[model samples]
Target chain A: MAVTAQTTKLDARKLRADFPIFEQTFHGKPLAFLDSAASSQKPRQMLDAMREFYETSYANVHRGVYQLAERATAALEGSREKVRELLNAPAAREVIFVRNATEGLNLVAYAWGLNNLGPGDIVLVTELEHHSNWVPWQYMAKKTGAEFRMLPLDEHGELDLGALDEAADGGNVKVVATGLVSNSLGTINPVEKLVAWAHERGAIFVCDAAQAAPHMTVDVQALGCDFLAISGHKMCGPSGIGAVWGRAELLERMEPFLLGGHMIRSVRFEGTTWGELPHKFEAGTAPMAEAVGFAAAIDYLHGIGFDAISAHEHELVSYALDRLAEVPGLTTYGPPADRRAGIVSFNFDDIHPHDVAQILDLEGVAIRAGHHCCQPLMQKLGVAATNRASFYLYTLPEEIDQLVDGLHKVKKVFA
Target chain B: MSDGLDSLYREIILDHYKNPRGHGVIESADAEAEGQNPLCGDEVSIYVAFGEDGETIDEVKFSGRGCAISQAATSMLTEMVQGRTATEVATLDKDELLEEIGIPLTPVRLKCAMLGLTTLKVALHKAKGTPLPEGIAGFDELDLK
Candidate 1:
């Protein structure tokens, strides 16, 4: 879908009306939700689609010869096609449904890393990765006795690409795993370049696109990464559903992470053979309803257009940076507005982040405050925790105004 | 501001947070234990020096970083536990601490308020080999090890 400048300028106020959550008030004030990085509030279209599917065509898929079963199977498979189009993958078979991005990353670390990596091999990850991205590889390295190296972040919180290149020089690097965007810092790394560098070293690249897929467009073929993982809940879909898109050849070669009823071609006493590309990864009964909801979310985002969403978020984040800078002693993290997504993490003076979050909560402004599942990154930043205010397509400028005003109140309370 | 927020962040709580009591460690401490709220990354360390009797706490102090509720509660706990027997500190319950804070905390924030007390109990446990009194918020979950 071609998005013009006119489409890029979304009427977020009008869009907010479509989300039922906005209609409710907190403490007799409009809810200014700034925690989209944690999980986005769903739109009515997605809710209605899931409801319609369950109410009308609920059945076990790929088993019964009945019409309901056929419809259910079609819906499930059709969601895969939607995911393929969303990520611009080569085929639907490349899209495997998992629980969430954590599960998807774990699948790769178990199914692929166990089979491929060994003592002499090295798995390089970045300090910018979320715990979900970091812990799995760390566990894998420990299990396989492979050396695990972390690519450090520069002072600007961007990934040190020079350092990554130096580490990859050894050619012992078998896997290069990192995030497309830093969830805590909001720093958008040079993923395309990293992918090419990994390819040159004959190493497989894995992009944790959980944060990137929601805020910007992701084309797997263009990225040329071996695998990419995405979460549905962060992108306005259900929580228990996500997708892992891998190169078909690599996926076919890897062993199944989880084995059970549906992921088998045939079961016998002698031995059992695995099913096809996507189904080989998806074991047992799948999250059929959540996948349907995810497809509807994709349609909702497409209706808004990613180009438009990106532009809107860019505007919001730029505005937020300017406003947050005006708050005294507010030290923001990550690169400048141009290099980041819609996330702004900061700490106000010596006031603890939890206090800032609580004071903001009093004013009906919601934000996340903690280590944000990136304790190692928190240690790197020289802080225990930070308050994060993240935006989405529906976020309005007035909410940021409320955030600044709330921070002022926090300063007053603590002062 | 809402009354709920005011009650939660009372002036006394802010005062304790700003000018904390026993803010430094006891250098020649007999026993020391650290507690962390894994949810928000709030940490508290309790250091105790037992008296000649080995039951009375001669000196008690805490040093850590956390939210206002945690810091203030820790400061208050230091004041309450000083000169008390390790057994008394060990038996101190969550209600006594909550009453001292004089605020109604949500289930989640209760962990923050009790961080100092929990760490103290762990320290007392280490010093006197006394078990932590049951019903302290997050006592079981606190990884003092």
Candidate 2:
């Protein structure tokens, strides 16, 4: 996806028609959404696809010989291929569906951690890692006696590459897991370089691409990482679905993380033989309708074109940063807008994050506040939380205007 | 900005957030415990200076960074609970406090508003060395407030 900086205005009237929820008023006020980083709003296409699946063809996959079951199985497997295409994954088998990025990362930590890492092994994480990516490794370190280390952030809230390179090239690291983009600060990490550094130390590199997949084009093969995890909900899909993309050979070599009925081909009271590569990890019945919804989400994005969507969001965030700069005593977090995605974290002098959010909500402007699943980043920034206004493809400059207008309201509340 | 914001940012609430009351360490206190909202990342370490005289709370102090609702509730709590018995404040109504602030809150914001009193109730129980009542820490769900 080549995003060449869209100069066109994002038409709210046209974009709002794609999202049905905009029709309803939230708290007796017109909703001005700005919380896409938390969970993106779904388009009608995705919702309609899920409803169609349930209404026309709904059955348990891979368990029955009935016609409906066969169709459901085909559709579920087809969604896996859609995800593979979406990420430019080399093979469809590398895409394993899971509950969300949290679950997908946990699978790698539990299965890969138990097999590859042991005493004296080191796993390198970073300050910008989401707790989902950080805590699982911490638990693995505690269980297997592997040392858990962190790559520090630079003064500008981006990764300190010199420090990361020193740790990565030190030869003590067995695995490296970091975010492709910072969810809190929106700093896009140098994944291409980080992957090379980790591989040089004979370590496997896994990227948490939850933030990156939603805002930019993701190519797992091009990224040259062993594995990448992303949630469907963040990318305009429904909840309860996500995918983990890994190299086919690596996934085949890794052990199964979760065990249940659908994961095994043959079972005895004492032991069981696992199924094929992807199915071996899918425990119980999967979120079938959700997988279909995810496919529709990819189709919806492809329709608008990912490059245009990303460029539109970039234009909006840049405009927002400029407008927010005019607010006195306001401090924006993370790297400058040019280097980051659309997520903007900031703090206003003499105002708490909750107050800012509450004031914004009164104006019908939705924003996210609190640790944002990055408590370590918050600790490093020396603040408990910051108010974040993140945008998606459907978000408009008018909404950014509303956010700027809302900040003035926030200042007045505390003034 | 609108005239409606004035109610939410009442003078007392801003005063407390700007200059919190009863800050610092309360040494040799009878009871002390820390409570934090992991959802919003707001924390408060409250120290209770209740004596063997029991019912009366000699002092209470809290330290945390949160919205005006939490800090204002804390500041008002220290003033409301000083020299009053633990039982009296526990029975004290939460609705009256919001009525004083004169701003209605959403379901989520009400928790920030009540975080102080809820923690105080727990600190009181710790002072008396009694079991905390079930669901005492979470009281914002009902419209009773």
Candidate 3:
């Protein structure tokens, strides 16, 4: 797919202007936002699309006969179609809308694992997984009396693929779940090879694309994963909206995660018949405007083109790694720049991550400081917490320079 | 360089953090309690020894690892409550500890500032049979009051 002419020639400085939050000065300086992994700043296009939906075409979807309801229903389904394209799923019916990636993962755990998994079955996850991906399977294993195993990372902060093969050699692995990209360490896993391994073991693969979907091109079909989950807020869309794309046959065989108004074909007093495919999974009133915003965000990302976004981020991460290495006592985690996304997690020698974050905040540089919902990963890395700086399309090279300047200030203060 | 940073990381706090007083465990302590800020992975353990009367804290010490504010606050807390009665230590307010640190804290940092006090209260409660006050130990449900 060719990128539109306008976006192919995009100037990031002008692109930054589209996000209104950038206009506001922080601490009497330009806000150097480096926390996009937590949640991305929304562009005007997404905001306007959501506002336009609520103002002009506001109505309940699917059942009402009114014109407004028809428009809303069309828009909602249209967004699903957009998501299908975004993920390169075979069909629109494979796209299931949920609250966020957490909810999407939970849905898979409940709907699929609860039914298919049993005693002696193993659900394999990695230490690199966010708590969302790890905990759901942990709960599922406990609830279903199955075994939950975690593949440990090597010293290089990359998943030990050898361990994965050894663990799956028994063929009891029912589900292989892992993240496409590590939110904390920024290591990008080889999902294509992982999916092939899972298939060879007769196990289903689930990819948590919460970090990958925003920064890279995620083609679920090309990766050949059984299920992939993505978050909307991480991709410049509104919060409380995310999607899961599953193989159509698998979605058909699995039961619904939630049951309510829109997800039923017929609800009798005694028993209820579930709706078809995606609707069966998405129960109750859906996030209509959020879905619209998600579609707009997809359009926005498409306008910029994934190739360009990936190339830009590669350069940024390379530069950031080189620049961050100059700071004394600064230690970073994750694979080298080529194997990672734009995230950089590090800590100064003696200064705690929280203190570093606090000091950096004084310079109007926003970075994340905490366990980053990867406590297991943190324990494995032998660190209490790390300061993470993540990048997005709007990030400028100068902002990274600013971050280096801020780190120097932190060193001086702690010295 | 900002005044806000100066207030948050005062010289006294940094001094205590770098060279903590009353650090290390009381090997023969009567009671001990450990607290952790799961959000930032800061941990503090407070150990206490009751005086002959078994009412006053004969010696109090803490051993843990955390940020500057948390460690310094723990060091300061051991010094502040060493000679006080267990009952008095149990009744010590969080504000008094914050005032002792003499720095304005955001809600997030307030938990760090109070980690030592919360651990001290728990240690006192365990030693002197005082009731454990709610919302003092858990950072998730820390009562800012």
Q: What digit string (tens of lDDT, one per residue) describes model 1 on residues A111-192? A: 9999899988889999888999899999999999998989998999998887876775554989999999889989998989
Q: Is candidate 1 or candidate 2 better by DockQ?
A: 1
DockQ of each: 0.74, 0.58, 0.74
* TM-score of every candidate: 0.96, 0.92, 0.95
Extract clashing residue pairs from model 2: none
Poorly placed runs, candidate 3 (over 4 Å): A1-10, A169-171, B127-129, B136-145
With a 3 Å backbone cut-off (N, CA, C), the pairs that clash in candidate 3 are none
Q: Given candidate 1, what's the lDDT at residue A156? A: 96
lDDT of 3 by residue, A320-351 (tens): 99999998899999999999998999989979
CA-RMSD of model 3: 2.6
Fnat (0 to 1) per candidate: 0.77, 0.73, 0.77
The TM-score obtained by model 2 is 0.92
- Model 1 CAPRI quality: medium
- Full candidate order by TM-score, most accurate first: 1, 3, 2
- What are the Cα lDDT values of the candidates? 0.89, 0.84, 0.89
Identify the runs in model 2 with alpha carbons over 4 angstroms from their true place: A1-13, A165-171, B1-7, B51-55, B86-103, B122-127, B133-145
Q: Which portions of model 1 miss their true places by more than 4 Å?
A: A1-7, A169-171, B132-145
